[model samples]
Target: MPFYSCFAHSLIQNGYHYSRKSPWTASQNIAAVESLGICHSFVLHCIISSFPGLPLVNPIPTKSLEGKSLIIRVFIEQFYENLEEATIGRWLKAEGDRVGDQEPLVEIITDKITFELPAPGSGVVRSIISREKSVVPVGCVIGLLGEPDDPLPDVSAENRATLERRQREVESQALIPSPETVAPEASVSERVRDRGKVRATPAARRVARENGMDLAEVAASIGGGLIQEEDVQRWIERRGSST
Candidate 1:
């Protein structure tokens, strides 16, 4: 009989001969079987070793709710940090009220920012998720607007003009100098100052600060003399483990 030097074949043969043999280590078995193009079997062995007899099944599909009323999620401002101070003012349309397209549904304010959130389509205001004075972030669902059994009439031209005037009045009251005009020179100076200060990025600085870590600790380990996010993360992990 020709002796097969194949590890997987040898293990299979031995496994049968010694039925009561001690179980082979996963890593050893995987290394042996993997060379024989038994990738699926190797993966199954690994999974079984890690989580014995756990049922594996594909996820079921979710039922689609097509033709449902459009939901508009509003953010108070363009940035995420403003969420802490943002406020949702009184609802322009009451809950369970029908509204037309482009109708002002709510007034949102953050920092010096104020704007009207318009109804995306003609629908009844089914529910309000966020109450007045509540701070909401970007992409937050503040309310649900659903299709009305009988939609309200579209806004007349005269009412549309009046609404436009109201919008203009609000815009005028909340106007602030554009960022570009207000900080053009300061922005340039800050960029130049930041470039000369250190090699670390702003994100890395933020991470270091939040973790109560000193940037100097990271500077000591990196050979390139530049502080990086990874260095900050590693420092954080080591510090956490030590504590």
Candidate 2:
């Protein structure tokens, strides 16, 4: 079934009298003619976002324009040539929060690296369609942006087709990464060992031994996490020039 049909049915089942077609007046709002305490614009936005690449169509008529929208669609650049999918790592900004242009709102992790999704334009995050840890394709609608009072846009058929066409073009240019391009990873034990290793100058080691102090202890006491001759001297000095 079409997304609008399914959503309309749900609303109607819940006692909402959705208009059969676009109509004018608040009582004839698209989704909730008799609904109360519900932001009709937000509901419409949610429904339209559920259907990717589909225009945000408001069959209902309104007195004014649809309103300004600042959409931040997922766009894979040429640098992401071989990546087909990524997992949502985290959301730095929540829905309804104001965001500055180019500010990172969400973190997405691919096989190679974790990157932040920057805001396309300064606006509020009206909706977060993509949830954390959900892996999705490259060109899907991950989230929505809009002004404080901006009503949901009526996505035209032509705009929907254009978005899909662009997505296809991006996929056509995708390439597979060379095996050598993959970086070597360190195992847990290796990482622990690397962290446990103490770096100290030869003079620092001698000073530590002469003062009955271990380099490990010196490293633990110092803020740098690395032991040095001056660190040992400072430790000795702090200890009244003795062990």
Candidate lDDT values, in order: 0.52, 0.57
Q: Flag regions of model 1 displaced more than 4 Å.
A: 1-85, 148-243
Tens-place lDDT per residue, model 1, 1-243, is 122234324545433221223443333233233223333222343343452222221112332223222332222324444344457987888888887656898888777677787764455786677788877544344665555542222223423454466567669956877777785656544543453544687888899889887776566445325678888999888888999
What TM-score goes with each of the models? 0.31, 0.37
Model 1 local distance difference test score: 0.52
lDDT of 1 at 113: 71
* Residues forming the 10-long window of minimal summed lDDT in candidate 2: 26-35
Worst 10 residues of 1 by lDDT: 51-60
lDDT of 1 at 111: 76
Candidate 1 residue 41 Cα shift, in angstroms, is 40
